[model samples]
Target: MQDSPQQPGSTGPTGSTVTSVDDPWVPSALEQERAAYRSARTRRSALVATASTLAMLGAVVALVGSSPGWPRVKETFFSWGKAVDSFPAVLDGLWLNIRVMLVCAVLIAILGLTLAVMRTVRGPVAFPLRLFATAYVDLFRGLPLLLVLFLLGFGAPALQLSGVPNSALFWGGCALVLSYSAYVAEVFRAGIESVHPSQRAAARSLGLSYGQTLRHVVLPQAVRRVVPALMNDLVSLQKDSGLIAVLGVIDAIRAAQIETASDFNYTPYVVAGALFVCLTIPMARFTDWVARRQGFHGAGGHL
Candidate 1:
């Protein structure tokens, strides 16, 4: 006898079956439509973003161009001719800034690491050193960097110490090291604290001495974790190196000021600012890249 007709939409050995909801092999019409809709929405969003950006930029340009002082401001601050004329002097002066920044950056790193280590020492015998480190951090971090720069740059020379370098650039670099080392020390200390206690315990279990553990395991991890922060402070230090100008050092800012006073035009200051921006952008980009890479590895528990 012939078997009863198979039910509609049911699977059978000899008959074609309807698509099952759980089956991944079949594509749903709803899903295809949703994907198409999403693609359309993304394109629309991009177009809107582009249009908004263009409109906002155009509005800014129009407003600035129509301002009453636009012509004079442009002539004084944005003059291509003046920028060209002043570029040489500003570039020449930036060399001093570079030198000071490089020197202070090295000193800051060394001093900061020393302070961080001093503060982190664990024992009753180390209490005095820890207290001194704490006081040092508190004092420098509390005082404004500008005040420190002034005191070091202007005040130090007044003492007329025989062995001290009287040069403003030297004093400025010293001030930066003293001030930034405090902040950098704190950054390092935070990184050190963030390390899991188990790591230290493991090092101890392996018969490593305190100093050896710190040198081999703790500090390497701490330094790696804090590199992005260190780089950020370095960028700020690079810009603040210009503060040497206040002490009559002929840095880019000082050169620009001289040019501005002579020509009665602000273009040189703009040029100096542009030079600083150029110097800082690459460092900022590098910091960002390090942060991203560290974050990626951290997420994977590789750090």
Candidate 2:
């Protein structure tokens, strides 16, 4: 008997059977509805996360607020009136910090780079310089920054050298640069070493001198690689600018001390700390952004 006529969706001459049921699978209304349900679940999970986070924060606040010392702590440390009253003086003193930070940052960069280069040189003729640089990094990196400040701020003046500036702010800033440059020098050296050795060989093959190779080919790549680390050091330097107050430089902390002495309350110190936090947070965020952007670009480049 001849085969019955093939239906519209029936098997073809290629020996492959095709029927209505063999058509490419497409989601039915029920499947689509399930997908929509899953999406809704995802959204609900996000909402749940947000709610949980807020609940935890609120619980912490409630716990802290219920403590017996909370009232006194609030009156002393969080008084709006005292904050308002002390803001102007603290702001004025913070300007000094800003100035010192800017100057020290520039000086530190220059000094650190110099020291890094000195440490990296390879010639026997440079032995003394390399030795000196090594000694400097070891000594300063080991010493506390506060001690450096005290020595420069008080001891240097005690020497009564004729040309030394008598100003506490000036000495304190110099000490900061001295101390921070040592740390930053190590950062710079690490960055310098991270550049691939092939890069240097390539530059030399192209007839570039050692200094030219370093300046044109190596340093830039190194700096880019270490930007995040360098920024972290800078943020630390900014905070440590507060340490100058120990030298009696009349910076934000010192100004806060004066206000506290006058008012006999701790609110001024809180205000000063808030001001520092405000200044540091923006830099910290910017550093994070740079790091993330660099990571994303690096990943893309690799792909």
lDDT of 2: 0.90
Instruction: Give candidate 2's error at residue 92 in angstroms.
Output: 1.0
- lDDT per residue as tens, model 1, 173-218: 8888999999999999988888889999999999999999999989
* Candidate 2 lDDT by residue in tens digits, 114-233: 999999989999999999999999999899998998888888887777877888988899989989999999999998887879999999999999999999998888788778888998
lDDT of 1 at 208: 100
Candidate 2, 77: how far from true, in Å? Answer: 1.2
TM-score of 1: 0.86
True lDDT of residue 66, candidate 2: 100
Stretches of model 2 off by over 4 angstroms after superposition: 1-42, 298-303
**Which candidate comes out best when scored by TM-score?**
1
Candidate topping lDDT: 1
